[model samples]
Target: MKVAVLGLDCATPQLVFDQFKSDLPNLSRLMAEGIYGELESTHPPITVPAWSCMMSSRDPGELGCYGFRNRKDHSYNGYSLANALAVQEPLVWDYLQEQGLRSILLGVPQTYPPRPILGEMVTCFLTPSTQSEYTYPAALKDEIERISGGYILDVENFRTDNKQAILDQIFEMTRRRFRVAKHLIAHHPWDFFMMVEMGVDRIHHGFWKYFDREHPKYEPGNPFENAMREYYQFVDQEIGEILSLLGQDCAVMVVSDHGAKKMVGGICINEWLMKQGYLRLKEAPSKPTPFSKVEIDWDHTLAWGEGGYYGRLFLNVKGREPRGQIEPGDYEKVRDRLIADIQAIEDPAGRGIGSIAMRPEELYRATRGIPPDLIVYFGNLDWRSVGSVGYGAVHTFDNDTGPDDANHAQHGIFILQVPGRTGGHNHDDLRVYDVAPTILDLFGVSISREMQGKIIR
Candidate 1:
């Protein structure tokens, strides 16, 4: 059977299955004729690792990708962006290719530096620019540019205050992506096809506050209250067009890397560490500054953290890091202490924020590469982790990087429709890893012993 997977980045279950269900008729119809539910995302629920985890049936630790960026080694300069080269795990399409089946991959994350496959390939948003070779055959880039009239890798500067420009860019990008997808489906030879649309994620991060009443910055009678809803409808219409092109034997699945929720604020992790006496610096900045730009006194610091949607804390163990302070014997002692302290943290109102911290070894089947000492969800992901120092207070509403209004949730939405099967069923226990196995099963491919998820059936 042919398989088509539609990936919507950061697509929240609430909007897909509940809040905007009536507006998303294409998705609503899919729900009535297919199995649908929330798909549990990876530990940190960030884009880079979550999509990699879903396609490879591996956890972030096994993939060795903690977030968008990872530390290459113990050195301070070891930090690098996670790309196609960083991941070595075999994906579902890799297994399919071994069986002599052709597959089409479009905009799948971590696909930049596009590798050769049995069929066509278009890299993900990580592609530096059109100047770079973004397509596998090299000539496909010209075809795509001709058909789509110019393609956008991703929305640039999505976190800016100018809402109109951001909205326009998002729509234009989505239009081009869908246009390219339809063109590929009509002309390419394929047994499996997959495309991920990033506009869902970009719009949520850019316009969530205006639509979500639970947002801290929500206002009554805003001009953009219906902005998110309109985008969903537009995406649904695009889905309908694609659905009409698929054959009767095609098995379709829709998924997201993670869900999106209103961000209450940010917890300046470096500032909090300084307050708790775990991190020491040579000199403090008068204003907020990135942690990487500051001079750290590694001899005195016990631990440090890198922040994004979640927090990654690294311990300064002797012999592991240069001028490390904590001895080898004190590694667990220091990690456990920091975990306890980070979890016990309270919000600005003095109420417990329900923060959670865990060791990387505790979450994955096997740890690979340079894993973080601790993975944390500040306020259970209601608040983002801020890596900047000199924020004065532990809590701040302003994002260090830009004006992001939302943070990722632990559960993303999923929908599966198998050919020649009874329709309508809700599978509530689905996980991101389960996707790879299910697709393999549909195509009669053997599930590898190394794969960590069960088939949905």
Candidate 2:
């Protein structure tokens, strides 16, 4: 069976079905033709682990990756940015290759330093440069550049105030990526083909404030108010082109790693921990500093948090960390206390901010790597956690990276279309892990026992 998977990063089911359904004709037609649903993403719902989990059918713990940054060692501070090399589990493509099925993979995340596959592979978002050997066999890189002008890995420097420039770059990037994809589809022979469009996620992050009417800072008649809609429409056209290239026997599936929503603001997590006496700095720096840069009094510190789309808290256990403080016997006691306190944290208005706190072992199949003591979704995904300290206040108006306007939501989009099918099926219980098993089943391959997700069919 021929299968084509199109990944629209950060696409939301609510926005696609409920709000902008009229704007996306391609997606709408797919939903009517087959099955569609709200697919639940990984815990914290960040990009790195979410996409990896979908491809491997393994939870974060089983995959040994939590987010973009993972603990390099068991020390209190050491961390390395996660990439394709960090993923321990075998990818679905690896399984397909074992069956002698040739596949083409393009622009999937955590695929940098492209590995050898049965067919061609152009690495994903983390590719350092087009000048680098981003494609398998190396020579394919030159051919791709000659065909599409150049390989567009991703839109660079997305955190600028210039919205129009960012939009233009996303458009050009999308166009080039699709151009290359069409070329490969037409020329290259393969049983399976998959590519992810990252422009959707970039647009959401840069323009959500303008698109989301519910945002407090939104302006009604803003020039870029309809930017998101226009971009989706453009993406729909691209999807239509892709579908037209495929034969009637090919099955199609469209998905997203996670969804996006308006970010209210950022919570200064390190400062809040300091105020609660859970964290102690040797000397409060005049300027905001990252956790790694500051001199921490580990003996006095009980718990500390690293900030991102959500907060990752680590406990100073006596034996685990170098300057450990919390005893092994009291590990549960301290963890429970911290979880309770984090759940009870309030907003500036004195209203309780509803948050979900979880222990890694309880949520995933195994806690392989140095797992966080507590994983928190601040204000339940509305407010991001700021890792920088010495902000003085508990809240901020912008992201530490730059002027990002959106945060990750729990649900993403999933649509599967089989030819000659009638009466569309809608599944509300789909999870990201289910995709891998379902895809394997479609190609007549056995789903591994290690995979936690069940086949949708």
Candidate 3:
């Protein structure tokens, strides 16, 4: 079986099917030709933990990941491989390698410092802030260096506050990735060909308004989002083209890690945390002259928030935490207490909001990969968690500008976008996690006895 896994960051199952059911004459036929549905994710259904779990087949807690950030050792300043390293448990690739099957991974996150990668890979999504050493897949340094353009690019650099520019950038990257995918697939005969279209998520965050055309943030005449109906069409064309090249007998599967949805309103969790005595922002002393801004004592700051990504409540464990306030054997207790407190937290006017929090135990049960150091749930997160995120302050600053428009916010309610799949979509929905085990199942590989998720077949 040859599976083509298309991971659209923050793509809701419905978004995928709804936008393309008829538009994608190709994928629609593929659906009839195979299996499809809304796939449920473990709780605290954020990306970092969810994607990692899908790849590794291990629960979040065991994988040692909390969110995109390693709160235990660092803050959410940038992506770090520290947590990835802690995921000593084996991955789907390891099993594939042992079985002598080759696979291809494109632009997947947390797979960086990519080692033990079973097949050919080109590292991606490596941000400018990432430590040079942490971004490269140590084993494939030569391959990455050989790519026409290095494996990593400052993707956000292509983004802009203008929707058209953002769309152009998305298409540009998509083209680059398509070419790369073709190269890898042709150069190496592989069992699985996986692609993560980071652009789709970026597009959703910046253009969810396009889908509805009624939100306060909606932009008119913004060619990209306003014409988003074509985005999926374009992607479908890409899929059709890829399919044309595949062997007819191979079974095909299209999977997205998480679905995307438009954000309702911003929640100043840190601001809320400050009111709850959970976070304290260090004050800047004396107004500074122009061109010279004040500094943030990241070291001294207590409980900071990083925009919409994880929607997490990270406690600064060092100097700022209440002395002995959260002690040993009480991690779960503190976690529960935090979740409860955050749940009770209300917006300034108190009109009943749609968010919740999670304890380590709840978080532990919620996922099969690294669990966030702290569990935070936003709004109903009907599917269990909010979408992607970006860098921003607790309350101020209008990220309505720059790449901030594309700052996270994709994953949401979806597993499938069928007439009956809407709210009822559940374990019954087509799942992305099932991709690995299903392939393993077909090959006669024992689904790892320790696997948290079940076989797709």
Candidate 4:
């Protein structure tokens, strides 16, 4: 079967699977035609990295990225796809081409300067925020532009989700994305065709509350909330259209790196560090830290996870941390103390923070080469985390009453649908890494031995 994979980043199967099967006639038909299932993703399940795993069939560490930014010590900058493509690694397209199979790729995240366009590919997802720097073969540019209508134009006006005008922008963008998808599929015919929708991820961050009962800003059918769901349905309809376009002799695979949920509260590790004396700040330093300004004592602070999966942790180390003050031997003690405190602490209303603090070994078995010193699993409340060390307050109150019964914490749930069945989500399901291997498997391709993922089929 010719495989066409569509990645809906931040889409939780649980949230949409049953709903789509019951409400979306087209999707239900596809489920009946082929295999489908909920795919479990990697830990700290954020975007850039998970999608990278899908492309490379390797863990982010092996691929050399854990999130949008590496966040080593205090260093920060976004990861680019150029570095990834240079690894001499065997991507699915490359493997398929060696075997003489043609493929087309478009909008796959963490992809840049689209290379080895066996058929035709336009890298739109994870595009540069400011300008277009397409890497597809020159032969395909005209075709791409013709179909895409001169590349995706970012919406100009910015309005909060609560505003109707902004909601309109979202609706327009969603339509544009589907238009591009249909046009591309119509213009190409190959063994494998892949596309990813980043709009889902962005919309979640911008309008998570409407969907989550626990969000402080949630207002279901709130114009923004309504718009988000409507956009999702629109995507479903688009999927139906794409399947129809594919006809027979092709199998449709839909997956997401992770899903969206609310973040009701967060644990500021920096604050905890300050309280624990692991970090010290001068009333005024001659120079400010990276995140700190002259007016803001940024020496020590807490944040929700800043990178991969938004669930990472790091310590301000002696040589690594600019504001490091903790003793080397005490790193474990500090982590233990914070983990204990965070694991047991509750929100202002008396709710536990995380279920528990897990040692790196205890949680993510595949470190991907560099695991954090600690892994924390927050309870059903919204999450706030960071992957660095510092001092300041550890816990703070975030206000947002959720939907009377809307589910709050669901970033890591499993995607279970007919035709494909994997165990439901658990901390151990690292299926996101399996994405790359599965794509390759569909084409009977092989990967390097150093790669960490296995073939999903």
TM-score of each: 0.99, 0.98, 0.77, 0.78
When superposed on Cα atoms, how far off is each prediction in RMSD? 0.8, 1.2, 6.2, 5.6
For each candidate, the alpha-carbon lDDT, in order, equals: 0.93, 0.89, 0.55, 0.56
Candidate 3, 327: how far from true, in Å? 5.5
What clash pairs does model 2 have?
Answer: none
Model 3 residue runs over 4 Å out of place are: 72-86, 116-118, 127-154, 219-225, 281-306, 315-337, 347-349, 365-373, 381-432
Q: Candidate 3: global Cα-lDDT? A: 0.55
Candidate 2 lDDT score at position 201: 95
lDDT of 2 by residue, 1-457 (tens): 6899999999998788789889888889999998999999999698898998999999999888888888888787688777888887987888999999999988999988888899999988888888787998688998899988977899999989998999999999999999988989889998999999999999999999997888867998999999999999999999999999988989999999999988998888889889988899999978777767899998899888988889999888888889888889999998888788888888888888887789999999997777788898989989998999878888888688788898899999999998876737888899999999999999999999999998976
Question: Can you write out model 4's per-residue Cα lDDT over 321-388, one digit (the tens) per residue?
Answer: 45454567877787777677656756657766555555655544354434456655555335554323
**What's the distance in Å from true for residue 250, model 3?**
1.9
**TM accuracy, model 2:** 0.98
Q: Which ten residues in a row have the lowest lDDT in candidate 3?
A: 382-391
Clashing pairs counted in every model: 0, 0, 35, 30
Candidates sorted on TM-score, descending? 1, 2, 4, 3
Top candidate by TM-score: 1
- Pitting candidate 2 against candidate 4, the one with the higher TM-score is 2
Which scores better on lDDT, 3 or 4? 4
